[model samples]
Target: MKTAICYYSRHHGNTRKVLEAMAGEGDIDLIDVTTRQVVRLEAYDCIGFASGIYGFEFHKGVVSFARQYLPEGKPVFFVYTYGGARGNGAKTMEALAREKGCLVLGEFSCKGYDTFGPFKLVGGLSKGHPDAQDLEDARRFYRDLVKRFSGGAQA
Candidate 1:
């Protein structure tokens, strides 16, 4: 299955690290939302939205891109990195994707090195996170999703 990940990784590039690990598994497109404002997503069998959480939400650029360019009824997944643990980090992105008439696949999130806001005073939180172990976990997650979706596409 052809897969694409539209992402915005800023600050420490923590989110990008995970994505790079997944992409290293091969056949995944990583579209940087900051540079590419518009994208053609129709050809992809599965789409992923990724970012470093800002204000406990996926970056606005990602949200806005989904609102504007996400094709309806496509399968969607989310990948996010956050400093602090939350009950459901992908809730906002999940709802938005659902509203766009997409099939919600799954989500993968991990701790990122965060120095945002008050955390900055103390240096940072989750330092060296989204580490080797985290990246391996992310790769496994992506592989599973690909395995699952590839079958459906073939069928």
Candidate 2:
């Protein structure tokens, strides 16, 4: 399948690390949303929305791109990295994907290094995150997601 992941990873490039592993497994396109505002998602069989969680939400660059460019009837999934060990971090993106009439292919989230705001003074939370194990898990998540959605173009 032709897959594409549009992401915004700042701070430690934690999210990017996981995505890099996922892309290594196959012909996956990794597009940094922070640098590119628009994407041609229609050409992909699967579209992945990814980002580093800030304030318990996905980065605004990713959110904005999804709202404006996500194609209808396509299969969409999410992958996010968060500082905290909780929350369903992909809801906003999921909701928008659904609103655009796309098939929800599910999500995968992992802990990422964070030092935004006060944490910077105290070093950071999830300091060595997107660690070896995290990257492996992310690779598995992507593999499984593609398998689960393998039979259908839309849900």
Which residue pairs come into collision in candidate 1? none
lDDT of 2 by residue, 4-87 (tens): 998998878888898999998777999987675557889999899998887788888999988877888788889999886546
Q: Assess candidate 2 and give its lDDT.
A: 0.84
Candidate 2: list runs displaced more than 4 Å.
85-88, 152-154
| TM-score attained by model 2 | 0.92
What clash pairs does model 2 have? none
For candidate 2, the clash count comes to 0
TM-score of every prediction relative to native: 0.93, 0.92
Give the winner by lDDT.
1
Q: Report the C-alpha lDDT of model 1 over 1-155, residue by residue, as the tens digit.
A: 68899999989999999999999875889999878655899988889999888887888898888887789889999999988764457788899888888888889999999998899999999999989999999999998988877777432
The C-alpha RMSD in Å for every predicted model, in order, reads: 1.8, 1.6
What value does the lDDT take at residue 78 in candidate 1? 96
